[model samples]
Target: MDQRTNRTFICSVLFIDIVECSTKPVEEQIWLKERFNALLSETIKDIAVNDRILLDTGDGAALGFLGDPEDALFVAMELRDSAMNDQRDPSLSLSIRMGINLGPVKLVKDINQQLNLIGDGINVAQRIMSFADPGKLLVSRSYYEVISCLSQEYAKLFSDEGLHADKHVRQHRIYAVGHYEFKKATIGVPVSRKTAPEPKEAPLTDQPQQGENRSIDTQASRYRKTITLLLATLPQRPFHKKWISAAIPLAILVVLFAAFALRGGKGTTENPSSPKVVTAVPRPKPSVTRVAPPDTKKTEPLRSTDPSISQPLSSKRVARIGFTLSAVERKGLDITLTVSLKNTAADARSVALYDNHYSWPKSHLTDKGGRSYEVQEVYFRKGGKRISMYDTGKTGIPINGGATVTAHLVFRKFPDSSREAVLNLHPFIYYGWRWTEHDVNFPDISLE
Candidate 1:
């Protein structure tokens, strides 16, 4: 064999780890460890060959790249999807927290003359991974800036993303990874140059998985399958709600036409313009209370005999979307709130749209009988102008009990202030599949 020589290169490094080891039987524990290591080794080897210009540092490897941040970023993201697929066990999940940095990397000769890497690029990539959440990847500002200059496609992607001031790292921006679900997007980033040929992007990230979802679409393939699965898996109770995709808008049109007809009483008598508040019916918010928590101390449903334990609610709700008070410790630009709704009204074809006001209702359970001890502090806005959602005392929707259905705000930002320890929910019914209302605020309640 020819003598191998150590080389120097700039590459992106990815770190894969086996986190949260379980205390199952020794055989079972060994099984998980072997599964992780085998998969991790294969992924690392693949990156070196195809995504060359990349590096791995064992549990996680920092990849160095000869290309711009765009190339490195793209490489890291693709690798992430690859790792996830190669490691098929979502429970006792085989995952990697990748960090990409565009810096100097070196391949030095080892005792057996194989190769080993060392440098700032390695250190920085490790740091970026440290700040990343599980199943997420992050990069340094320098990497981002480089990506911006290389491709406008990445620029637009980063600009629309929710960036976080690193939780532990000081003074740097770490964009959250959960925000990147390519499969859910109908229109994706246009990562092409005006003069150059476009590069091919990968398959959608929202691809189907086991457990209530699959790669194959069923007879009921909805555009918002992700949302459907999310709501299905989310902790929810049997609250009555109706699906209003068509009727709500019809109601609005009816009201608009009525106003026009009222003022068009040509000649015989002139129509007088006056406040219509007296005739306007007050509308209720399109709110959704999450399904009550799963009952403990009973035979847990959704049987899984894989020999692993159930994860806490955090992994379920916090990782994705759920009804949470503004007080949740959200990272990035701010927490993005998405409301999902259903309507169950019988008489009214659809529900009416109303002003959405946010309130935090504080409650604690002294006992498990379900009667929550609540200090429900309700209001929106801080300053001198206090906007109270409960001004009428009942801030809940009767929704005709069994007849009313539901809707929610999809593109909402966390209100400036959120009520502390509030339970239940408040969903805003809106016009688009995308619903979200920003700049809503909540303040701490005064305990008198």
Candidate 2:
């Protein structure tokens, strides 16, 4: 291969790191890597051979996509979902954290002269993967921007995860692609049992195993005995062959006539019956009684003193959501958003404000100009002190039914020209087979 011609190109890089592979037994680790490679190949088989590259990273691997950036994004999610549905041994459970980034990279020959990817592209991708929760996918800002423009459906899968400070790179904006099933699988939640139930043994009497031949012989003997008895009961005298043949036709004709007689005939008309005199009965009309109308002057209008008591209940009595953009403050590139959410859901539920878990809920802000910003920092005020959502080890703000909670969401500042924005709450829900977008739009509010 010509080193110069094959060396470099701009492409999307997908770096996947197996979570805790070193902690597992060496045998188990080997099994996990084999399974991971098999799944990765099966999932991205549609991509052309020359357009993609897979380099084993010991615990995980790095995949390069020379085609559309969307393909890399798709393959990442597909691998996660497929791994979740994998029926491998539970002991060999494989969970991966994947990161996708698009940039220019150089391909070089290693000591073994094998093609290896080296550049800021793959390096940054590996760092991004480290930040991801196991079985989750994270993407760089560039990858997000490109894919979002290519397909809206694919765009909805990603939620902004604010600026992440890396050791090698300064603050980098990252977006997370939602994969709930993969998250559950990583936590060892068996969505479907891999091992099938054991087969039950059949009863000796019902099962036709050793005694099958004997049973058949017994049935044959009984049939033979029945035939012998019927033959004995039959007349012993021999009848003429001609008479027998003629009687068979006559019997068939008589039976056909009898069947027709009993069936009330196909085209035959019925005999006329005597006409009887008719009589008519009439129904009595309902009586209409006139009554005076009630006195309107003595009645008072019904009313309630509390406005909340008079407020009509929502038709959907399940989860009633109310959102408001309380305040917005900007300091340089950082913006703080105060949002108040009311949940009248039947149970005490947490609105996914932010979380460190791969499976946690997420919220984003979309400006009127169609630009979206992911929440960078999340905290709430309680007892006159700010409580960080991440430090509290809670995925979202907890609100009881018929109660409201407020949280402060921070994000990279919107463009200085942005005057209005919409807060997207619970933007995505993964249903295993497919995903659902349940973005609750908060009314547009002024940034001022």
TM-score of each: 0.36, 0.42
Compared with the true structure, the alpha-carbon lDDT of candidate 1 equals 0.38
User: Stretches of candidate 1 above 4 Å error?
Assistant: 1-8, 21-58, 66-71, 82-91, 159-171, 177-448
For lDDT, the strongest prediction is: 2
Report every candidate's CA lDDT: 0.38, 0.59
Report the lDDT tens digits of candidate 2 across residue range 18-83: 899989999988898899889988887777876677798899999877655666876787788788
Number of colliding residue pairs in each model: 59, 0
> Which ten-residue region of model 2 has the weakest summed lDDT?
274-283
Tens-digit lDDT string for candidate 1 (35-154): 655654554453334334333343434444432234455445555665566645555555556666666666675676555567776766666566565667666665665444432334
